[model samples]
Target: MNINIDIDFGNLWEALSAIGTIGAVIVSLWLARKDGKKKFQVVLKTTIGMRNDNSIDETPYLSIDAVNKSNIPLTIEEVGFINKRDGKKVTVTNQNFLIDGSNRLPTKTESYSLAMFVFNQEQLFKELQKKWPQGKKIRAYVRDSSGKHHFSKHYKI
Candidate 1:
């Protein structure tokens, strides 16, 4: 006995095309999610300002502003100022400089400020001005609850 079968080429092509389309959609979605994770970030800004005191006169300070611009919350590990030329870092950690030592930073809509007192404002400003052209930077080191580290862009102060 002999068996005979017929294969429809057009239907096979259509099925293959549908499978390819589905696969492409799955890959695209996966890539999109991965890129979305990269978009979750924190931004840091630094400024020098003067605060007046009634009896002690005016004091100048450096203010560090950290903003969570991502969809997820972040735990700030360290905040610092770096002298690019000498590789010297002045960090808030292990020091009493930070006005608020709290570590948690809320998601996208929240911001935190850390203040460091400048003993001599004019001297500090002069040094910063010279170093600013040489790549002085403010750095914020942060991590997610999952312990994944995220570094903010090097902000030129």
Candidate 2:
């Protein structure tokens, strides 16, 4: 058997174009994922901190220091902390968050940033010293204007 047929170049071109479009979308998704992963790494590294300075008296009053590295005044939308007491962890937060300043400026501000919990205050530290007389570890975190959080170079409790 012998068969001969003329190919429609217009149809062939359209098929190739569809394939090209699909390939482009796949590439775009891959690039976006890679970028997203890189961003997570940056934030993670800048967030977690080491407990090198273990001074018990280093007042752990939660506060925030905002630096406007971006070319505009960035506003922090939230700040919170997680603390452990009696083998249980608790979270404290302030939703009415705001960091105000101009571009290329750093704002050093502190308000009612302390935890009102009786256990998290300094009085508890004194009690711990009298009872356990051992070091207690509490992790603190601060969220910035961009919602990136960094922990303290840990202190003692």
Candidate 3:
């Protein structure tokens, strides 16, 4: 026995058009989501010494800098480090020891600009060491005014 099935080219063209329309809709939605998401960058720096007039004095400190990479401006509410192992947070509130200290909290950081919080190296190190003696990794973080938390990659404690 022989069986012959007829396929219509017109119907096949319509089906392909439907698939293309669906794909275009999906790409549009994805791009919209990507554009709506917030973009904030965090950087960590350690200063072990300060050189002044042929003299390099020991000024060990850790600085957490948050830069607003998005078009909108955001205020940095807090900056700190968290132990990656146990989720322990160490917030540095006292600005007395900050290398470039701010007079108050929730400092405004404009787009493409940064706000830095500095902490005495020995002081922060001691506190973190006491909290997690065996933990060797930590991540720097900054909380924005809208309660959005932005974090950096792990750094060896």
Candidate 4:
């Protein structure tokens, strides 16, 4: 006895097209998911204010604000100022510099007054007032819970 197998060209073409369409859909979905993860991000802002301690003179202070727009929490490791001209990092060793925030910054929330520095106020004021050397910037070094470091754009003052 002999068995004959029939090959249908039209059916084969239709099956191939279906497989291609399925593959394309899978690839599109994967790309969408990968891009979605990048939507989670953190933003930082800095400003200067005056603080007086029962004195006639007012002292300038630096305030940093951190906003978490991502779905996960972030940890702010260090905060300081950067002299844009010579690219120098400045940090006060005194107790006036305070870091106030949870180790884990929650998602989709703003942390106000996260850090404040009262030291070197006069020097900072002089830098801001001076025309030479351009301007100064605030820098905050942060990391995620997974220990992935994230940097914010330099906020010029």
Predicted model with the maximum TM-score: 3
**Residue clash pairs of candidate 3:** none
Per-residue lDDT for 10-35 in model 3, tens only? 77789999999999999999998876
Q: Order of all candidates by TM-score, from best down to worst?
A: 3, 1, 4, 2
lDDT per residue, candidate 2, 1-157, as tens digits? 9999987667778999999999999999998776543111011011222244853443332233333333234334333333435543333332222112211212222331221111224543454355443466554444444566544343355
RMSD of each: 7.2, 11.2, 4.3, 7.9
Residue-level lDDT of model 4, residues 6-26, one tens digit each, is: 976677789899999999999
- The positional error of residue 48 in candidate 3, measured at the CA in angstroms, is 5.0
| Candidate numbers, best lDDT first, in rank order | 3, 1, 4, 2
lDDT for residue 122 in candidate 2, whole number 0-100? 52
Best by lDDT: 3
Regions of model 1 farther than 4 Å from truth: 1-24, 31-40, 48-64, 69-72, 81-91, 100-138
Better of 1 and 4 by TM-score: 1
The regions of model 4 sitting more than 4 angstroms off are 1-59, 78-96, 99-138
| Candidate 3 local lDDT, residue 134 | 46
Task: Give the Cα error of residue 27 in candidate 3, in Å.
Answer: 1.7
Q: C-alpha displacement of 27 in model 4, angstroms?
A: 6.3
Q: How does candidate 1 fare on TM-score?
A: 0.44
